[model samples]
Target: MIERDHPTLSVGRQCRLLSLSRSSFYYRPAGETELNLDLMRLIDEQLLETPFYGVRQMARHLRNEGHAVNDKRVRRLMRRMGLMPIYQKPNTSKPAKGHKRYPYLLRGLRVERPNQVWCADITYLPMRRGFLYLVAIMDWHTRKVLAWRLSNTMEAEFCVEALTEAIQRFGLPEIMNTDSQKMVVSSRVV
Candidate 1:
């Protein structure tokens, strides 16, 4: 540690003892350039309108608006501003080839009874160390979670197990519904 106000050691002697260059010690960090600041302000406003635009698209948009910006530069400024594009991230819900999609039965149907309509959905659960997948079977009318299961893996077995428990506890519903994504995602038989 260099003590500039120390009565004993001179500033030059302190620098020598610390093995530090004078220029480096005197150097203060200067923030982003003026052009970068203006660009970032424009980017901030445009980001609110279209949050799905990624680095390349954002750069192209800026270039189209007569701003000389590259993807790398746009990416850097966006990163510095802590901004990320909102888009569909790849997940484990991709359907298999030639899978038959079923029509939604409860679209206009009035679910008057508890067991009249049932639905199941799957989502991710945030954990301290990592994440766990959760599948819940709910009664449409009661809005109750009849059965649920948590699994570290996204296998169909856990989802099926939850559904089986719900069906065992209560009689079969008139209509069975789940997210369309769960068609080929969870189980083909469910």
Candidate 2:
């Protein structure tokens, strides 16, 4: 925390003591304007109805609703609200650059026994207010869910926790698969 008008301490000194950057200490977040807020509300309501609407579609919808807005503004507001079209889009599954790529090892291998292969996936569960991220680890042969965890944010910690729990309960599998690009192959798995 930073106090602007401290009794004796200077702002710079307070920032240094708190291990915070001077710029961050001085920075204040800009609030959305009334028009932007109204647009955001409309976008949210429309998103519930048409989850597949992209920037262009959203802009057209707003225009039809009598709001004079451009695609750029709609795109910015959608990004700010963390909303994305739910439909499948091309090139959305690219792996991160500089990350080690592992070949798909289960192409021809048969999963004859439980724990032979395991798969994990993360999905979003829509709720009344927002959505929750669900991560699950399952046995490939048996199709049994070994562990699951729900999180408000889509961070790797919950997925890692679920994997850890599954391994602890059922022991390690011969192979593990996931669609996430951020998953790193540990030495134990290798």
Candidate 3:
């Protein structure tokens, strides 16, 4: 777990040597109150059941369930959870500076061959004590997973590592699809 041997080395190279996901290295524990944790858990479960519920509906549902939560609290919790009702709406999530926003390039494009298009997604990993983030690449045509990596931090570099490994193994795809998440579109890594 010590990188002292390689003085002034790149972090990604160090991470590769340890057989550990870079995310596992930077995961931070939630510092919210126990009550807020309870509320977040409740809100997460409810959101899973009804992703369309906005803060107003979530607050009402929580109140009906006797949680004593208000809309403002619910809104904050939802933002923390990265939960959004999937629908057509303004792009509320913004990318970081200099991160290239790749237009959705695969709208009606037919993926008739392997590696024609690939998609990447980052997800949260629930643990008994804490959580980690997982990034994965998938082939659009065969629905096959090409590469995946997990990390404890929200840094974009872990996603870059996953992307690099995917490209090394399968070569670059004609199109790579990802949500508006900043990590996925970072030009610094590309």
Candidate 4:
């Protein structure tokens, strides 16, 4: 709670004391117009069927469906809704600058035991309202899930927690492999 008019504390001082941003403390959400909301719903439904649609393509789609929308509006709506075209592109998952790169050690290595090789990965699970991230650790040889965690954000903490739980429960593997997206944190754990 924020006291707009306190006896001694100013609003800014109160916000600072509470560790809250002044802008956020005074922010008010603007309601979306009904027409725009309807268009957003249409765009979301269309996105479900065509996950590869970009701004221009989506605008064309909406136009074809008898909606008076342009690329700029579609782009803004997509940005607001956090809708991005899912496609294969070069350099999509590059490592952060100055991060150490590890050699790919499992090129031809054969897994013979349960603890020989373990793999971990994080993937997005889309839901009706929003999305969640799933981090899973699995034994390569046995194809068994050692540990898994679900989070609403893609923070490294959840991935690290999942890895720690797996290691604590199933013991350390000879090699733990993970996708490049999560390699930065998993490397620290390994």
Tell me the tens digit of each residue's lDDT in model 4 across 27-141.
Answer: 9998788999999999999999999788888999999999999999999999999999886443325567887667787888888999788898877776534577898999989
lDDT of 1 by residue, 89-154 (tens): 437678778977876655577779888778888888755345688999998799999999999887
Instruction: State TM-scores per candidate.
Output: 0.49, 0.48, 0.46, 0.49
Please list the residue runs of candidate 2 whose C-alpha ends up more than 4 Å from where it truly belongs after superposition.
1-97, 181-190
Candidate 3 segments exceeding 4 Å error = 1-94, 181-189
Q: Clashing residue pairs in candidate 1, if any?
A: none
Tens-digit lDDT track for model 3 on 18-121?
88777877778768999999999998898889876778888999999989888889889889888876433332255678976655666677789997778888
- Model 3 CA lDDT for position 99: 71
**1 against 3, candidate with superior lDDT:** 1
lDDT by residue (87-148, candidate 2, tens digit) is 74223245567868777777788889998888988787765356788889998899999999
Minimum summed lDDT over a 10-residue window in model 3 is located at 181-190
Which predicted model would earn the best TM-score?
Answer: 1
Clashing pairs in 2: none
- Tell how far residue 36 is off in model 2, in angstroms: 32
